[model samples]
Target chain A: GAGVSQSPRYKVAKRGQDVALRCDPISGHVSLFWYQQALGQGPEFLTYFQNEAQLDKSGLPSDRFFAERPEGSVSTLKIQRTQQEDSAVYLCASSLTGGLGNTIYFGEGSWLTVV
Target chain B: AQSVTQLDSHVSVSEGTPVLLRCNYSSSYSPSLFWYVQHPNKGLQLLLKYTSAATLVKGINGFEAEFKKSETSFHLTKPSAHMSDAAEYFCVVSEDTGGFKTIFGAGTRLFVKA
Candidate 1:
């Protein structure tokens, strides 16, 4: 079965540019999450959505970071006016249920470089 | 707030030697603990999880972790190391504080020597 899918495994953008990263969660998954990981560090939470409703966006670093899951299955993280400090890997994860009883799976991640 | 701490930033072991990666968590509620492994160029894979059911949890690829509430630890261990086990390991924790939120610890990079 397909776990989770992310597009454009690598991306390089000029500073102040805008970029959008896409994620395709597994079929029937009710929960989706996004995280940012810098080199040599663990993943940091970005946002989460349960079905079409986004319940958490507190982890988003700044207003420049925006995410949307209009259809509930596919989600997008958009960054406006990117900065060099935003260089990191964006990871997408999903689970059958967001409860503590279910396990979450992750995608290969889209590595972004801001120059 | 919930958080996890991976004790070692890195650990090296020879092939066939015992492997251990330690993690400690802080949560206000009964926490769900998980261990995930990420190989180079690959996505994060679930190794095991403990959801307050059992103290000892076993995962894929011959990995296991013990959830000790007394010491607030969920340490992953393997009886023997394989060269292919070299990768980064992350200890994750989820807590339901009004809403469920998961947090990841600083990863532990395992170097398996042949």
Candidate 2:
């Protein structure tokens, strides 16, 4: 793909139903990131991966929110026991390097609606 | 902790008038700064970045920003506004925590009036 790709552009889940969001970063990009954007707000960092290593997950809201990049190219963000508050647009970005001054490209995002 | 504050939630300007979006940042280390624009129902696009090499950074669409370290500000400016320039803007600060971690401001919505 020319840029980062994400699956399920929109998702609607019943309260307490689990959902999984997928991200496919740009080819050979060493850094991948996940962010959550509430309506009328900027994207908030959720987690970061350096290749296959999950370097940071500090921004994940709760224990039910988990992310993994097993092969370093594709990543998944899984939410267990979904809540209404979890409704937001989930964005994925990729950078050539996870260092200072690197530019990151973002995907259109997966819009989640938890009822 | 590194954070950025966008001074205005919404800014309105005439199509031909100048544009100014104010931002202030707080960081414990030398930071990397950026501006990203989001069109309605579209993904974010990078406008510009400050990487310490220059105090004045020029971005696409004739937009630019000056990094004022003493003032803790990085304000985006354009000589004239265009109707198409209406969008949401975000001010971001990235600091190295093992690797670079980025924090984004709430966002400023720009409205260009005809």
Candidate 3:
């Protein structure tokens, strides 16, 4: 794809249910990132991957949230036992290289509504 | 740590008026700064970025920002506001922590009144 692509653009998950959001980054990109944005707020970092390696998971809110880019291209973010507070937009971004001064491309994002 | 602060939560300007969005940042190292805009229900788009090369950076849609090391500020500005410019703007600071870890400010919602 020419840009980062995200699947399940919108989802409504019941409390205690699990949800998975998928992201396909730009081809040959070496870095991928996940962010969570609540209503009227800026996106907050969730995790980061350098190719297949999960280099940073410091921003994940809890153990219930998990992300993986097993093949260094496609990634998935899973929220287990979703709660009401989990409602937000999950954004995926990728950069050509993880190096300094690289521009990161963003996807449209997955809107999750926990009911 | 690195952090960004957007001074205003909301800013209103009449169409054709000048626009200014203030941003301040704190970083332990020389930071890479960026400005991103988000339209309603749309993904974020990069407006501009400030690398080490230039203190004044030009961006798309007639937007520009100046990085002032002494002030620790990277403020976005436009000579005139367009109706299409109404959107949310975020200030971001990226630091190298093995890889770049970007931190975003709370965002400023710009409203252009006709």
Candidate 4:
């Protein structure tokens, strides 16, 4: 709506369990990004999408970390077989265009804890 | 390759005192630099950015950063510190090489003492 929105603000998952987080970027934005932030650290880029096409997935930590923006509007990040080390905050951001010159807006983020 | 380094892990200042947060970056090409602030349990908010425009970039909340190409630094400064300014600050660098790649610094935590 007004800004980037994320779902499941907080999540607790058992080790080896699968979890999904959702993000809704600002309407009509053309670029979307996902980042992972650990305690006391800055957010690290996970992946990027230009419209519905996934142009870059190089930053995904592992194969288990999958993100998809199927329709170019809403996106989802899925983590399989979650590990304790995977616990962190997942941030979603969107920009008006697909480059670095534009200002990217961020969501509150989804906090995940693996137990 | 592009990278950003925030010099201090933590900084403490009394309310109303001058504030400074240092940042340096390395980029292969002309880089876009940015400063973002994150409050407790809140999303990141952009403070300011320096593209190819003015070297002195002003942002909201009385924050400003100057892009120095000679030293490859974009340090953030404020004339005075406010209690509300206590938060984590991050320096970011972006370079477009086929992909829009962005790198973030480790972050500096600002503590304002009253």
Candidate 5:
């Protein structure tokens, strides 16, 4: 693909429902990141992956949010028991290098609405 | 610890006039700074980055930022504003502190008036 591709551009979930968002990063990109962006706010870091290794998950808001990149190519972010506060855009980004100061390419993001 | 602060929540500029967006950062080590623009309903696009290489960095769309270590600021500037430049701008700081994490500011909304 030309850039990072995210699935389910928009999703509306009921309270207590579980929702999964998928992200396909650029070809052979070594680093993948997940972020949450609320309305009128900048994107906040959620998790990061270096290949198949889950090196960092410090930014995940709570235990209900889980992200995995098992094969190191595609990643999924699953949220359990969605709350109204969870309604926001989830963005996926990828970078060629796994270090500070590296440029990251972002996807269009998946807009999630919890009713 | 490293963080970024965007001074203004909103800035309005007339087309063809100069644009200035203020940003300040705090870092314990040499930091890498970036400016990203996000249009309505669109993904963020990198405008420019300032590493340790050069103090002045030029980015896409006639946008540029200067790194001032003494002031702890990396303010974005453009000679002339355009209507198409209306968007949200974010200031980001990255440092290899606890881990490789990128911190984003609250973001400033730029409104260009024709």
Candidate 6:
């Protein structure tokens, strides 16, 4: 079975530009999550979606960050006016259920660089 | 708030030697613990998890962790290290304070020497 996957493995953008990263979760997965990982640091939660309803967006750092999963499978994280501080890897993960203890699988992540 | 701490930023061991990765967690409520491994240029992979079922948890590739509620610790250990074990290890904690949220530690880099 195919695990979670992201598109455009690498992206470079100038500060103040807008960028979108896509994620295709595993088939039949009901839960999706987004995380941001800075160099030499662990991933930090960005948002979470259960099916099409976003259950959590508390981890999003600021208003410039946004995410959506309209069809309940694929998701996209969009950043408006990208900042130099946003240069990091954006990771996507999915799980079978919305349970707190459910095992979440991750994608290779989209590496974004803001200059 | 829930958080996880990985004591060592890096650990190096010779092949066939024992491997230990220490992790401690702090949570207001009972938490679900997990260990994830990330090879260079790869995604994170689940090694094991403790969901309040057992104190001693076993995982893949000869790995295991003991959950101590008193100490608030869930340290990962392997009897023998393999060259392939060189990677970054993260200790994670899941809590349902308001909704399901997972937190990750700083990660420990494991270097296996021949």
Top model number, lDDT = 6
lDDT of 2 by residue, A6-109 (tens): 98999999999999999999999999999999999889999999999998899999999999999999999999999999999999999999888799899999
Chain A TM-score across all models, in listed order: 0.97, 0.98, 0.99, 0.98, 0.98, 0.98
Lowest lDDT 10-residue stretch of candidate 6 chain B: B94-103
User: TM-score of predicted model 3?
Assistant: 0.99
Candidates in order, TM-scores: namely 0.98, 0.99, 0.99, 0.99, 0.98, 0.98
Q: A5-110, model 4: which lDDT tens digit per residue? A: 9999999999999999999999999999999999988999999999999988999999999999999999999999999999999999999998667898899999
Clashes by residue pair, model 2:
none
Candidate 2: misplaced stretches above 4 Å? Answer: none
Worst 10 residues of 5 chain A by lDDT: A96-105
Give the per-residue lDDT digits (tens) of candidate 1, residues B1-114: 788999999999999999999999998899999999999989999999998887998889999999999999999999999999999999999987756688999999999999
Candidate 3 C-alpha lDDT tens digits along A4-107? 99999999999999999999999999999999999988999999999999989999999999999999999999999999999999999999998867898899
Question: Model 6 chain A — which ten-residue stretch has the worst lDDT?
Answer: A1-10
List the RMSD of every prediction in angstroms. 0.9, 0.7, 0.7, 0.7, 0.8, 0.9
**Considering lDDT, which of the candidate structures 3 and 4 is the better prediction for this target?**
3
What tens-digit string does per-residue lDDT give for candidate 5 at B56-113? 9999999999999999999999999999999999999988765678889999999998
lDDT of 6 by residue, B1-114 (tens): 899999999999999999999999999988999999999999999999999998999999999999999999999999999999999999999987767899999999999999
Cand. 6 TM to true fold: 0.98
Give per-residue CA lDDT, model 2, range B23-64, as digits (tens): 999999999999999999898999999999989999999999
Least well predicted 10-residue stretch by lDDT in candidate 3 chain B:
B95-104
- How does model 1 fare in lDDT? 0.93
Calculate each model's fnat, 2 decimals: 0.75, 0.69, 0.53, 0.69, 0.69, 0.78
Question: Model 3's lDDT to the true fold?
Answer: 0.95
Identify the CAPRI category of the predicted complex in candidate 1.
high
Q: DockQ of each candidate's interface versus the true one?
A: 0.81, 0.79, 0.75, 0.80, 0.80, 0.86
